[model samples]
Target: MSTDGKSPLPPMDWPDFQPGWVWLTGAGPGDPGLLTLHGLNALRQADVIVYDALVDERLLGWARTGALIEYAGKRGGKPSPKQRDISLRLVELARSGKRVLRLKGGDPFVFGRGGEEALSLVEAGVPFRIIPGVTAGVGGLAYAGIPVTHRDVNQSVTFLTGHDQNGLAPDRIDWDAIGRGSPVIVMYMAMKHLDQIAAKLIASGRNAAEPVAIVCNASLPDQQVLETTLSRAAADVAASGLTPPALVVVGGVVPLRQALDWRDGLADASVLDAIGRRTRDAG
Candidate 1:
């Protein structure tokens, strides 16, 4: 409220969502609240919202009534719109004088095809802005009550994708190096190849019994976690029947979830089928 009886909704520094342009925004993980202020603002004014599979549908409620909501999510092993086609659609929408907001899950640059889309926009000369959202590794671990880095455990953590563009576990990365040095490893889009990845880690220098936590639909009501060891992770995940859009965390930090789990194992049913030892103290 103001003296003029007007609401100070958006600050003066807020950038207007101009037509004939596009905004590449990260929608964060599965929680609607993880959406950035800029992302919400773009949603309110966007004539077309191109959202992804991991993006919570609840966030779309912020969009102005009658706005066009389009799905362009790329889930592994599922039929998805071609990446090239999706990028061209944004250009087409902007050229047609529509305010386009290309919404993605997690930080657009981190494993999201945002760079490819941004390049497409640049080649086509479409003006655009980038609004970074909370990446899954950060927010997901927070929800699971696992610290990304623990002083007692190790100061270094590694973040990587399980599969490459071709949907195969990345071979170029030196898993041996990561397993030998990295104290904590957070992986995204890894459910499909969890077994192969775990084998690589074991073959590299990581202990077979190293604690591993698989988080499914993190930061959302239906979040499920499987706390197991690196050796049993694949079998436990298979037996538990957890699905994709999940994260696999391997390190001593996995045990921290027992104390930090605020989900309380109640209505949200945050199931934790632990196949490893659990203790209240991190030490």
Candidate 2:
């Protein structure tokens, strides 16, 4: 663990991540410990850290003092800095010959708009490197004791965004195909539109009784997991009233959460019982 702002700047293994370029790195699903070694190296060496709303700020403490930190996060329905501006800023920073770190929550490439930013940097002739982190769909589910791939429950899994920034199920995605083809589904940023998303899945042949677990603030101390069935997910989540930056898992593996969940323990048995009893009731 490198101390915040004190290193004499040791030699780096990846010469490609040197100054004069931007590194788009994922900060993991909310836990600083889950940060990749490459991501941590970037944080320590960065001349600036341009981060998202979901990123854990504590991770910024790793950056050297006097490092410029920019907030570029955009939440759904909230006034936010435009994506074009954020991309332009990255180009500017690299053009200024600074070691830029574009820190994002979860995996940068996984719905983090990293591809857009990278494209902009490339078009501007700015050299860049990508450091992948643990995406929330997998890490968040693990924290909630939900395995994305279980031989008994599902041989395949599908990942989808709950809604587009416009607050509608993405028209670009074939929900019917995803619903019928994928045995397991993991959703990101879906809390607000879970009801509509659930309905679409059910209409597409997903069983209303399928188990669902919403893991909020995954991998963090304040994390909360809500367990419910597909038919009840929308209402139960609405009633709980948890905030965003959550991951939702829907499939038979949700039931395994009762036994496999090790993080945060079972003192909150309600989350576990919700799945078991709900499954029985539906049966």
Candidate 3:
């Protein structure tokens, strides 16, 4: 019998963190709470952790004692490590018999480029496990009270990257088909080319007055949600002085934020101030 306890919970059966293996795990947007148990488990046992720019630095607190933590984050327009070099470094670390954890923000498979790293591991004969985490496209929007899908708003939704490998808006996207078919569009890394994207959508028949929302620093206390129209999104965002690491959502469902925005109560005064500014501008 335990002292003042009804019963002790059974121990969790966690996977062993063996040396000479790499684990590509998602840290989930910016909130440490959103991290998966598997990710936490990996953190506690990792010999070395290579983390991304968007990952919450607080999560590193869970790393076991003496663990080496390396920053491998790549922010756009910043001096960052090349993808090939990063992948090769993982291979090198695994070859050194380290329990390597490549921690990325959001799901490793979604836009996080875990696939490329995984392929490199495969070619180099390094063992690895893929752990998916909550992507900002859905999780970030949820924190902002914007549902990616709604029965009344959209039956289907689309997710796309804002830019391609060349750091420019992707030329291969069929804007006309997407604008016509997708009732809701959630874009990643799109703020840089938002003006062009908005123009393309307008040319493809999407309404200029369609609702749009930009959620920045998603899931973190500093999260900001900016509301605007399709035609005015680029200008409004520019005027507001918001930066990257933001998700752009375009569709009819965006207006529902007026009622569904639950974060307002918990958000800091800056968020309220921004919202107030947007409201006054809209008026």
Error of 2 at 217 (Å): 0.8
Residue range with the least summed lDDT across 10 consecutive positions in model 1: 274-283
lDDT of 1 by residue, 26-63 (tens): 99987899898788778877899999988999998778
**TM-scores of all models?**
0.90, 0.90, 0.90
User: For each candidate, how many residue pairs have backbone atoms clashing (under 3 Å)?
Assistant: 0, 0, 0
Worst 10 residues of 2 by lDDT: 1-10
lDDT scores of the candidates, listed in order: 0.86, 0.86, 0.89
- For model 2, how does the per-residue alpha-carbon lDDT over 133-235 read when each residue is reduced to its tens digit? 9999998888888889877557899998988757787778898999888878899988988888899889998889888889999999999989888999999
Runs off by more than 4 Å, candidate 3: 1-10, 266-283
Note the residue pairs that clash in candidate 1.
Answer: none
RMSD of 2: 3.4
- lDDT by residue (1-283, candidate 3, tens digit) is 1112323223677788899999999999889999998898888889999999999999998787789999999999999999999999999999999999999999999999999999999999999999899999999999998889878557899999999998999999999999999989999999999999999999999888878999999999999889989999999999999998999999866765666678885434345445444433332
Cα lDDT of model 2 overall? Answer: 0.86
Ranking by TM-score: 3, 1, 2
Better of 2 and 3 by TM-score: 3
RMSD of each: 4.5, 3.4, 5.8
